[model samples]
Structure formats: structure tokens, C-alpha cells
Target: MEYIDPHLHMVSRTTDDYETLARMGCVAISEPAFWAGFDRGSVESFRDYFRQLTDFEPKRAAQYGISHYTWLCINAKEAENVTLSREVIAMIPEFLDAKNVLGIGEIGLNKNTRNEATIFLEHLDLAVKYNQQILIHTPHLEDKYQGTRMILDMLMGDSRINRSRVLVDHVEEHTIEHVLENGFWAGMTLYPVSKCTPQRAVDMIERYGPERLMANSAGDWGPSKPTAIPDLIMEMKKRGHSKELIRRVVYENPKTFFSQSKPFVHG
Candidate 1:
């Protein structure tokens, strides 16, 4: 079945990876700005990167019939550099009108530091001002629970944020309940190493019933499988899930959530 991988770093993947995604039924993807494996020294580095996201990557994905969309923000790892993070957040608006641009995101705490929360709220301010849909990256492993709580608290404190337009991604069993119960969408990142596995993702779907949930490969520079969403489909089928139910999680859920963005015109 055709699907959308809502979170992946295509810039870190090869053209062959894109072809494989096409063959595996990935019709579109949304790439969020993330750490480049290092701290960038200046805002100019981010400007160039945003240009690549809004310009280069989409054309590259089109070669294999995959629509590309992007979200812009200095990730939490870099957000500790408050001065630099503010500069990057200020510069993000220049690219907001790009046809493939989605919103300010994958923006949440990494170490759950004070600086990270400050920058996260600032990015939230930017998104609310622009009326952009949000895509959040919750903390990993041990930090996931508290960081998600902090994020939800921050989001709740801001009355301007529309809960339904935001997606808190990388949710596991411990964190998914708060995300969905509070009226925000959740994403299960299917990875071979960390985050949810394909089977665990299917488990969440069974338990939660796939109302406001979706799955992603989160393919990046690390050890992650780009076609993990298809694995989720196979797992759901293996457990005797109806194709409609499987498609609702992998394809329709993301498409519905992302449709809230004006630049995401792909159906």
C-alpha cells in the first residue's frame, strides 16, 4: 500500500534509497531539520541548509515520484546555543513560503535543558505566528517521559497553539498516552535499534486503535531502516489486521495531519 514516512532525513540518504522507497510504496516524506552530527558555527550554515531543504531535496525526491516536504528549526542539540538558536529561528521565516515548507519543528527538548525549553517555546511562538502545523521530536530513552511532559506543559501554557495541528513524534508506550489523551497527534518511530519496533508499533495501534497515531522510519545518518513503515504494514497484516486498519496508521493518518499545512498539496 502507498504510504507517507512523516519523519526522515532524506538529505542524509542516497538516491538509491529514494528509489528503494519508491519501490516500497512511499509516496511522500516530510524531512525535519535536525543536527548535522555537529554544532554549526553560524546562521549562514543554517541558511544554506534551509535552501537545500526547500530547494534541492524536493527535486531529488521527484526522480522516483515521492513528494518531499520539510520543517525548519535548529534541533534541540543545537538549541543550547541560545544566540545561534534565536538567529536560526528568526531566519526560518524566509523559507516558510517555500512550496514544500511545512512548519517549525522536530522542535522539542533533547537533554531537557533550560536553554532547550526556551528555544522550544520560541519555535512554538514562530509556528503560532505563522499558523504553521507543528512536528515535534520528543526526547529519547530515559529523557522521553519527562521531556514529553515538559513539552506538553509548554504547549498547554500557550493558549495560541492548536493542539490538533501539532504532532509529538517518537512516542513509545510510556509517552503515547499523554500525547493522544491531551488531543495532540503522536508518531511511533520504527527503528531497529532504538524507539519502537515494528511489532511494538503494531501493538500500540492495537491498544490505542490508531485514532491519532502514525508511524515513521525516522531514517537518518544513524543505524535506522528507511522502509520501516512497510515493516509496520507487514506486521499489522501478520497479526490479521485489516488492510484498511493498516493503511489508516501508515498512510491516511499522516496525510490527514500533514494536510493541515498549506504547502503539502500532495494527495
Candidate 2:
């Protein structure tokens, strides 16, 4: 079935990967800015990276007939540098008008530090100011719960934030309930090594029942699978789930959430 992988870092993948994704039924994808293997040295580095995301990556994806949308932010791991973070934030406006640009996101706590929180709030303000939708990244491993909570509290505190316009991603069994209970959309990132697996993602879908929930490959540089969403589709099939239910989770849910964006024009 055709699907959308809502979150994947194509920058880290080969052009052959794009061909594989297209062949596997991935018609569209959204790439959020994240850590680039290491801390970048300056705002100029981020400037070049954003150019790559906003300019180059879209063209690359187009070669395979995939629609590429993107979110811009100095991801949490780099948010520790308040001065540099602010500079990147200020510079992001230069690319907001790009046809493929989505919004400010994958912006949430990493280690849940004070600086990260400060930067997170600032990114929120940027999104609100621009009337843009948001995509968040909750911390992983043992830090996931508290970091997710902290991110939620900050978002809830802001009256300007329309919860439906935000998607808190990387949710597991423990954190998915909180994200959905609070009225925001949730994304389960299917990974080969870490995060949740295809079977466990199906378990969450069974429990959650697919209203404001979706899944993604989150394919990136690490030990991840670009075709992980297809793995999820296979799992749902193995469990005797209907095609309607599978389509809602893998395709419609992301289309609905991304419909709020200025640049998301997928058919």
C-alpha cells in the first residue's frame, strides 16, 4: 500500500535508498533537522545544512517521485549552546518560504536540561509566531518519560499552542498514553536497532486504536531501516488487521496532521 514515512533523515541515506523507498510504496516523507553525527562548529555550518535540507534534499527526493518536506531546528543535543542555538533560530527564517519547508521542529528536550528547555520554548515561539505546525522529538532510553513530560508541560502552558497542530514523536508504550491523552498527535518511530520495533508498534496501534496516531521509518545514519514502515505494514497484516485500519495508521493519519502545514501539498 502507498504510505508516508513522516519522519526520516534522507540526508544520511544514499540515493539508492530513495529508489528503494519509492519501490516500497513510500510516496512522501518529512525530514526534521536532527544531530548530524556530531556537534556543528558554527551557525554557518547550520546555514549550509539548512540549505542542504531546504534546497538539495528535495531535489534528490524528486528524482524518485517522492515529495520531501522538512522542519528546521538546532536539535536538542545542540541546544546546549544557547548563543549558537539562538543564532540558528534567527537564521531559519531565511528558508521558511521554501516550497518544501514545513515548520520548526523535532524540537524538544534531549537530556531535559535547562538550556534545552529554553531553546525548546524559543522554537515554540518561532513556530507560533510563524503560524507553523510543530513536530517534536522526545528523549530516548531512561530519559524518555521525564523528558516527554517536561516537553508536554511547556507546550500545555502556552495558550497559543493548538495541541492538534503538534506531533510528539518517538512515543513508546509508557509515553504514548500521555501524548495522546493530552490531545496531541503521536508518532511511533520504527527502528531496526533502538526505539520500538514493528511488532511492538502494532501492539501500540491495537491499544491506541489509531486516532491521531501514526508510524514512521525514521530512517537515518544509525542502525535504522528506511523501509521500517513497510515492516510495520507487514506486521499489521500478519495480525489479521484490515487494510482500512492499516491505511489510517500509516497514511491518512500523517496526511491529516501535515494538512495544517503551509507547504504540505501531497495528494
Give all candidates' CA lDDT scores. 0.93, 0.94
Question: What local lDDT does model 2 show for residue 212?
Answer: 98
Which RMSD values do the candidates have, in order?
0.6, 0.7
Tens digits of per-residue lDDT for model 1, 1-267 = 999999999999999999999999999999999999989999999999999999999999999999999999999999999999999999999999999988888899999999999999999999988899999999998999999999999999999999999999999999999999999999999987678899988888889888989999999999999999889888888899998998888889998999998888878
TM-score of 2: 0.99
- Each candidate structure's count of clashing pairs: 0, 0
Per-model TM against the reference: 0.99, 0.99
Local error of candidate 2 at 234, Å? 0.3
Stretches of candidate 1 exceeding 4 Å from the true structure = none
Q: Residues 55-146, candidate 2, lDDT per residue (tens digit)?
A: 99999999999999999999999999999999999999998998998888889999999999999999999999989899999999999999
Evaluated at residue 231, the lDDT of candidate 2 is 94
